[model samples]
Target: MADRRLAIEAWESLFRAQHEVFEVLSNDFVGTDLSQAEYDVLLTVTRSPAMTARLRDVTANMLISQPSVSRLVDRMVGRGLVTKCNDPDDGRGALVTATDLGVRAFRAIGAAHGKRIAEQMSRLDDDELLALRALTEKLRAGVDVDEA
Candidate 1:
């Protein structure tokens, strides 16, 4: 087993690094029409098949609460960035699809944001980036296992 002190230090380092990177990258959204949370939703929805996704899936991928995601989606709906409809397979479930406006907005921001992400991540060499991705995925897999 790893030493408790070492484990704690590693966890703190990971947390702090995430916060620092997020803080820096979040600046990419400063002048955008969408907030960070809204962008996250669009990113997921836009990447899904037919440019649509289940609301539950969106909530699952988000860092916020279910109710918070619901409210955010409602606001996005009002803005015509996305449209919500009842899931055909599940009467009680909702589906969200990006509007044409949403696609254009997301694509514009995504192109710029992608460049920013690449620039920010360029701090690490390729090998280091691969290692970091592996470590994070391992950590995430452990959490998934625990949930299962």
Candidate 2:
């Protein structure tokens, strides 16, 4: 086992780095039609097949509570960004589909947000970035994540 002290220090470093980068990258959302949280939801939705995703899948990717996610989806529905309907596969679950406007906005924000992320991550070379991703993935590998 690694030294407990070193383990704690490494965890702290990873946490702080993620928080700091999140703070810095959040500036990319300013003056945008979508907030950071909304962008996250759309990110998951847009990446899914047919620009649609299960609400639970979105909820899984979000840090917020399920109820909060539902509320956000409702707001997005009001904005004509997405539509919600009962999942055919799961009667108790719902599916969220991105509207054309939602896809447009997501793509618009995504282009710049992606560039900003790349710029922030540029501090590390490609190899370092790959290693970082590997380490993170390894860390998360203990948990089971569903691919949808």
Pick the TM-score winner.
1
Q: What tens digits encode model 1's per-residue C-alpha lDDT throughout 38-68?
A: 9999999999999999999999899998899
Segments of candidate 2 deviating more than 4 angstroms: 143-148
Measured with C-alpha atoms, the lDDT of residue 135 in candidate 1 is 94
Which residue pairs collide in model 2, if any?
A: none
**Tens digits of per-residue lDDT for model 2, 22-41:** 99999999999999999999
Q: Whole-model Cα lDDT per candidate?
A: 0.94, 0.95
Q: What is the lDDT of candidate 1?
A: 0.94
CA lDDT of 90 in candidate 2?
100
lDDT score for residue 93 of model 2: 98
